[model samples]
Target: MAIEIYGIKNCDTMKKARAWLDAAGIEYRLHDYKVEGADPDRLKQWAGVVGWEKLLNRAGTTFRKLPEDDRAVADADGAIALMVAHPSLIKRPVVEYDGGVLVGFSGDKWDEMLR
Candidate 1:
């Protein structure tokens, strides 16, 4: 399967996900949002798959630092806009594998999908 992993390079979760892929010998492409920027269209697509609540990283500093007005707007469109402006506001280690997409990394989930 062809996998495309997206996240900031230095994130601990991203590091773990990359390491897991490497150990499993999974060939995947890395798309660093810090460098490439997160695409709104892609974010919308991911939201369709995982829902806006799952795609947005409200616990992250990027989201927490947003102004009250911006933070209050938490719908799909609002969240997508925030993510487009601050890619770090999105969850870490979003991986696209073939026709399926996985947001966030859990060792068990990775093992099941990769195995």
Candidate 2:
């Protein structure tokens, strides 16, 4: 399957990642969280692979704005629940490529994997 990238369509980081994919002539399909809602089961699977720490976008405004009770998630289940309810809490451009997955984008890393 072609690599599938998940992120908000207008996210700056997502824009950068999309640019790299386009410039590299790579085939990919964007799964915009805004347009297509996230699945809790899929989110859980991603968390299982990369860990909830990597999947959660703690640096984003959405996460920062969360109430203490929501932010005080104690486990993967809590994190995943929040991520599902607030898709913006998800780190941008989670790429499902080949048989593996990449949680964020980097030019060098993309080059390495695509190569």
Candidate 3:
């Protein structure tokens, strides 16, 4: 079951998710967007599965600090562009497993799907 976790390495949510995966004995790879940068193609793919709305992290400080026009995105394309430009705008710890993609961290949901 190829599982890849994506997020900023220093994010608290990323730390918690990594700890959970480690404790669960789950083998996975970390795709730290802060270091490697986000891919437009991959962002588009994730958006397709979960909807750009769910992938975009409007509540995060990065989004909050964006220009008003950037935050006023009206569609997936707009959101994707924003995310690609600012990877921090995407929700943290997006896990992509063999079955599907999971956006954000929720212990119950992670256990149900990842465990």
Estimate every model's Cα lDDT from 0 to 1: 0.91, 0.90, 0.93
Per-prediction RMSD in angstroms?
0.9, 1.0, 0.7
Cα lDDT of candidate 3 equals: 0.93
lDDT of 2 by residue, 1-115 (tens): 5799999999999999999998999989999999998889999999899999999989888988999899888899999899999999999889998877898888998888864
Model 3: lowest-lDDT 10 consecutive positions: 60-69
Model 2: per-residue Cα lDDT at residue 41: 94
Worst 10 residues of 1 by lDDT: 106-115
For each candidate in turn, the TM-score is 0.96, 0.96, 0.97
- Total backbone collisions for each predicted model: 0, 0, 0
Residue 19, candidate 1: alpha-carbon lDDT = 95
Candidate 1's TM-score: 0.96
Clashing pairs in 1: none
Overall local distance difference test of candidate 1: 0.91
Compose the digit string of candidate 1's lDDT tens values, residues 1-115.
8899999999999999999999998999999998999999999999999898898898988888889999997589998998899999889989998768899999899788766
Number of the top candidate by lDDT? 3
